[model samples]
Target: MNFTGVSGQLQFDLEKNLIQPAYDVLNIGGTGFRKIGYWSNSSGLSTTEPETLYGKSFNTSTRTPHLYSVIWPGETIATPRGWVFPNNGRPLRIAVPERVSYKDFVSKDKSPPGVRGYCIDIFEAAINLLPYPVPRTYMLYGDGKRNPQYTDLVGQVALNNFDAAVGDVTITTNRTRMVDFTQPYMESGLVVVVPVKQVKSNPWAFLKPFTIEMWLVTGAFFLLVGVVVWILEHRINHEFRGPPREQLMTIFWFSFSTMFFSHRENTVSTLGRLVLIIWLFVVLIINSSYTASLTSILTVQQLTSRIEGIDSLISSNDPIGVQDGSFSWKYLVNELNIAESRLVTLKTMEDYIKALQDGPKRGGVAAIVDELPYIELFMSATKCAFRTVGQEFTKSGWGFAFQRDSPLAVDLSTAILQLSENGDLQKIHNKWLRSSECSMQLNEMDADRLSLTSFWGLFLICGIACFIALAVFFCRILLQYRRFSPETVEGDVEEIELPPRSGRRSLRTASFKNLMDFVDKKEIEIKHMLKRKSSDNKQEASPSSDGKSHSPS
Candidate 1:
């Protein structure tokens, strides 16, 4: 018989008539098998010469050697790729786990609708990514009311009882050993769920508004403003000059009183007034912020947790709640070394709430340990009553299960990857996982109240103002010292030099020291002269041992 192909014409004869190779020829064929022998191309099949194979040729010189050996047309011995249901139109059996807790991920009930959830939506969307349609029907893997063991659901696929298993099945090393899993559509990890309560009032609660660093910085600025004010005012402002102890008290009183806008002493110098203006502005901002923060702390109810994380639960003799038939029970025992006595099996979200509310003392668990998705769903329903403490500890992903080395795993995995890239996966996730009615509750943190970083710029402005004022004040003092020398200010006297005590003093240093001494003496004389004038005014205002008042004349 003759056959035509893109290469050229070829002829086939019965396998029995073909000359066999010199080596042993194994006759392992049935009646339907035939062999091709001759080619009429420009270059015929060749064993030694490469040109004969590349260039077309008619092999008239010798019978064409067997170019290749293959089963005759219309005889297929290899199994086909993909799901090939027997011609009876049987749909693919997809096993969906009946989850008691977090039914939003997978729910199976007989009330009209059978199977539905986040996992279901993701699976259907992924199947659509394939070029061909997959006829599938969801079969519940457990009795409709209880949580199903995921291992059993996966095992059915391995045993050929089901075509595939879907719905929140975590991929593990042991499960993978039995069946292949597609790339995960949802991330999974364990989280600690605990009940929350309002914080109680205490004596130290007043100090909760500002961090320690913030308080220290504020106190240091109070002293800084006081020092800067006295430096600028002491020379000319009579209120600033008094006994050393009195002057110290005045600096303290003036700086703090500014907070209430009740400082009695007035600034006399122009630069002193500028410094006060900047300080008052900074004080206003600080006062308003502190007032608002402290008011919120006192008026609002704060939420806190005594159990910080898994470590806290392990150290205590409290019972820990785990979802019944979950992977958490084994993880808590084997990986975390938690005692079985501390484990409590919770089958529903209501069970979780009751266990946490009763507490360990009242026959309840201290905390519920479960996967992140389940805990998040519970939190959404309860809203503000519970919170997840600490980070996710264990790591895994939810994936679909298939028979071992099934080609469907690769195609399904590719589809999931496409869904993730094009944002279809997130759309499915938001449709089921996110709740529009639940308002996310955040813990009121002390870090949010107030910090030094918030007001550093204002403080910088005030500091710069004080620095400029002090610079001007010092410049005036230096000018006065140079114009009125010590010899001229006091009575003229012969100069006498004393030897330095330890460090040798230069002429410039000695002159500066003498000028400072002269300034101090002049300041003292001014104070005494003012005191004498005050006394004279008092004496004139009064009568000498008589009721009549006396004038200076």
Candidate 2:
């Protein structure tokens, strides 16, 4: 009954003597004899029984019992029972469920007609990491009419129907009770998939980068800079000094045109040039940043959605989609507290698309919630028809399934860990799922837009500079007006001293009139001086003429 020393032994004698003379046989493990079965060349295999076979020798002089045991290469001794069993040498039966999209996971068109996909490639790569080779055969489960649920696929391993169930089989706590799984090779989680509703282009989309307040502030600064430049240069710079209408046009033209660095006015005063320099730099920065931000906003479509995240979908009381029999269904029902009445069960990518297109008002789901792999696959195929919203929730991963206590699980897990670290897993994923059509959409969704908040400090700096320049211009105008006031007169003109009773009224009335009178007096004195100089020149010329006439005689 005990197989103590049979570990190293190649073969053991089943029985010593018999009429037929049966020879040596191999043991399955080093455990006590449990039962035996018969393997015959003609009659076919028979049931295993405890007793051995007996043969008649005619005289019945010798008697022997037929012993039988199953054996293969790479068999190891089972602990406690000391049973010798081959873990890898035998062909492993792998169960694959029938799914059209998932057919790539295990296809019949291949040379051997078996499994191959993101999951299958990962499984084979992990197995290859071991020192020995593993021979395997794939048995597809489910009727051809419908794809099997993940539960039914994993159940095959639990029922001892196959060594493992390999596919996009998700690992969950409920399934863990029935079967053991290796370390997760693919990270999986639920995501909200909504129709990629195109955002209508705003006629004012160009103005979105900066807020209304910012735009208003920017416009005000533009005008302020223009008016300050005109005030400082109007008297000296002829280009700026013109008729009222022409001057008004010049102010605006110079201010706005500076945005494009195409102004015509030339600043003459030192103060005017300083202001212009600062203003020009500010305009350059503003224009450059505005162009950059505006370009980004237009090139990268700004997508907007009613359902920003899972919470929004729930709060809106809109119908939600759950892939039939996916873990997301249970997650929605239990974790999210979504009512069954609101949940719409979807079975395929087409179903997801149809539900989203139908919209919430027409008995369609507002959003579809499913695993990330399926979502990615769906998005890639549809080319931006739908987009995944919200952060992934209820984290889980996909892994190969095995019966509880299977010895291969540990080794397979170890191999998988090695593959993951070596980057083989990512390479497999890329081979199966990578696509370029949706790359722009995916990247655009992830990119952030420029907001007014990003450039508020720059705008503030420009605004402050413009306001200071305006204040300086106004102060200069006031100083010039004071310099021409009558109170500072120094010629022999008598100062009119008002009578005591009329002093207040006289001061108030005469202030403006006296200022005008001073301007008139200055003009008259300039004309008189010119006349006196002209007469003196004429007299000197006449005397010179007389002298020349006498010299000629």
The local distance difference test score of each candidate is 0.76, 0.69
Clash totals, every prediction: 7, 4
Q: Candidate 2 residues 1-553, lDDT tens each?
A: 2233432213234663222223333344445334454533222233432124433112222323344434433542222223223553467788877665545444444556455666778888887776544667888877755556788778878998888988788899889999999989888888888876444677986776666666777787788889878877765677886577998999899989988899877888777887888888877877777786666666654334478778888888889988765767777888889898999887667788788888888888888888888887888778877887678876899888988897677778999999878888778878888552544442233243445576677667666766777678657544544654354433334558878999888777677665544433332353454465468679999999989988955
TM-score of 1: 0.63
What's the alpha carbon RMSD for model 1?
A: 13.4
State how far residue 261 of model 1 sits from its true place (Å): 8.0
For candidate 1, the lDDT comes to 0.76
Candidate 2 wrong stretches, greater than 4 Å: 1-93, 106-113, 133-137, 159-162, 197-214, 302-304, 421-424, 441-456, 473-484, 487-553
TM-score of each: 0.63, 0.68
